[model samples]
Target: MKNLVLGVNDAIYRACIGVAGLAIVIMALIIPWGVFSRYALGQGLGWPEPIAILLMVLFTFVGAAASYRAGAHMAVNALSDRLPPQVQPFLTLFVRLAMAAISLFMLVWGYKLCVATWNQYLSTLTWLRVGLSYAPIPLGGFITLLFVLEQLLYGDQHKRRVVDYECTEDSKEAV
Candidate 1:
């Protein structure tokens, strides 16, 4: 059962990484094309900037979830580290609970925001619904919530091979 859950998470994590990577790659191509078309070709394109912005949003939210699962998200542990050993577990629990709360907030409020804006469309990209632009928020929140639950149930996955590829590679090299 544990292996099944971890395997599922591993697939999800890989998908997140791929999505974020694709968004970045497309944005990189789109931005340069936009610049080149505007300056060199003497005709500005309307789609690139908005598309890039949307991709950035996707990258940010999705990448954030991936980072969290991998324990790569920014966290200042100075205060926690200085605390007594016995208090550390409590602090860890507190942090996880706090993350769960934040994830829930994002899921609920973001879905509300998306629904509220569903009827509207982006002015620059007439076919694209404004709500669609906000989809990543709830999606990312849900993904992160899954990861948090996994942590609460199974313990920290930071050392997992899927999450820490570099460490795995180093260990392989040592062997």
Candidate 2:
């Protein structure tokens, strides 16, 4: 059962990484083309900016999920680390609960935003719906919620620890 859950988590992590990487690469190419078309061609494309922004949203939100799973997100562990070993569990639990609350907010409000803007169209790109612009917000929140649940149940970033081999002695030796 643990192996199955971990396998799913690993798959999600890899998918997030791949999506973020693809979004970044596409943004890189699009930005340059937008610049070239505007200055060199004297006819700026109308779609590039919107597309780039969407891609950035994709990269940021998905990348954040991946980072959180890997324990790469910035965290203030200094104080917690100094606490007595017995107190550490409580501290970690408190922090995770706080994180869960924030994730819930993002999920709720983000989805609200998406729904609110559902009828609206992008000014720059008429064909695109404005609701889609806010997709990353809810998506990222949901992804984070999944990770947080995993931690709350299993303790710590179990998926990434295994996926990244963070617990291996060799990694510590290198550091």
Full-model lDDT for every candidate: 0.92, 0.86
Q: What is the lDDT of candidate 1?
A: 0.92
Give the TM-score comparing model 1 with the true structure, all chains together: 0.91
Candidate No. with top lDDT: 1
Error of 1 at 141 (Å): 0.4
Which runs in model 1 stand beyond 4 Å of their true positions? 162-175
Candidate 2 error regions (>4 Å) = 158-175
lDDT of 2 by residue, 1-175 (tens): 5566666877898899999999999999999999999999999899889899999998998899888888889888899989999999998899888888988888999999999999999999998889989999899998888888888877676444564533457877887
**Model 1, range 1-175, lDDT digits (tens) per residue?**
7777888988898899999999999999999999999999999999999999999999998999999999999999999999999999999999998999999899999999999999999999999999999999999998999899989988889777653433455687897
